[model samples]
Target: MVQFHKGFPLELGPVEAFRPNDIQHAAADFPELNFGIHHMGDPYVDETISIASRFDNIFLILPLWFNQYYLQPYKMLHRLGDALLFVGAERICYGSEAFIWPHVQTYIDTLATLQMPDELQDKWGYPEITREMRENILGKVFARGLGIDIEAKKRELAAA
Candidate 1:
């Protein structure tokens, strides 16, 4: 797996690197390789989703976008909804950067209680957050993607 911060454009400050539309060529060029787009390309969520949706090998790591939960949680919910609706749970992963780990519980808490508004579901057809979906984003999806046996890991950790 290869991952990059989409890091570029200093004028944009610390939000994100804008859009990731230009990544298609490399993704197409390397069909057998997997690409994890960090930050979910922030304001370019649609673009990120478009790329991820088009390529089975493309995935999203959510540490940056997930930080919005500490500032504007509603926006995070919509983004989460969009990711789930467009790419589904399997491609979404909660990436806790080292700095983010200290406050990771907040992200976990917000996601734990995250729910799409009823009108949103009626209007946008976004799926309501379910326990199974929540669990996947928490780490299950990443573990499964890496071919890790979760039950075995749990036992191993317990024994430790």
Candidate 2:
């Protein structure tokens, strides 16, 4: 589990193929492993959040795809927001999953445009969410979750 988690890169898509039982086994084998679940586990945000909360080894990375705006009628973002709260921001990281530099900028702008309630914003450790939170979402939770001890990793990355 540690080898897999250490070796796996963020470019990989949502970990839908990984079952909870597999996670449980991995956690049992390596309690210190950091397993990042992406996009709220693709189509199962609630279950993904639940799994994150249930297992200390599980953490979440909020990757950009369809912004909160594209969730349609707001149901999708609302469900995602609710689930995100359940998992708490400290356990959540951020990513754009952008294919290029321009797409990365678009993701930054999109995140800035997202309107979040005060309570949620506070939980996210920001007065209000902006593209700035991207850094925190990228490295903060991940650093703490994995307890990444390498000084080099810490120097190269920022923590929440």
Candidate 3:
């Protein structure tokens, strides 16, 4: 899996930041690998969405985006709408860059409070973020992407 973070281009140094075409080419070149773009590619959210829409193996992880939860919620919501509309909830997953930002519970709590506004939901033609969708984004989607059978694992643990 490949994780690309272009949110802070300056911190990335001379790398010139990540672009959608880069992911497009990589996905095309290596169809077997799963690609995950972190922070939903932040400032490049639309591009990320576009790339994800085209590539079945590409996924978006929400880590820094949640860290900025309170600071810029509207922007996050906007990007969330675009991603949900383009790729559906199954292709997106939640992540916590906990090693760098240790307040993991705080991020989880903030994410729990997020709800797509009714107006935006209507505008985007997507349903409200249901509990099932939230659960999928938090774990099921990622597990499925990795080809892990969560229910089977649970059953095995229960049998232990």
**Residue 40's C-alpha lDDT in candidate 3?**
76
Candidate 1 matches the true fold with a TM-score of: 0.79
- Model 3 residue 98 lDDT score: 35
Each model's TM-score?
0.79, 0.59, 0.86
TM-score of 3: 0.86
In model 3, which runs have C-alpha deviations exceeding 4 angstroms? 10-15, 96-99
RMSD of 1: 3.3
Tens digits of per-residue lDDT for model 3 on 1-160? 6666755465646544655558888898999988888877766778788999999999888876666657777677878888888888888888534337466777767666679988888886756887887887888878887778999999999999
Going through the candidates in the order shown, the clash numbers are 0, 2, 0
Estimate, for each residue in 1-160, the C-alpha lDDT of model 2 and write its tens digit. 1312211235676544533335546665776676766555545556666767777777666654345555562554565466555766666665324334455656556555666666655565334444544445556556666665556676778663
Between prediction 1 and prediction 3, which has the larger lDDT? 3
State the lDDT of candidate 1 residue by residue for 130-159, as single tens digits.
898889888886776565799999999999
The whole-model C-alpha lDDT of candidate 1 against the native structure comes to 0.76
Write the number of the candidate with greater lDDT, choosing between 1 and 2: 1
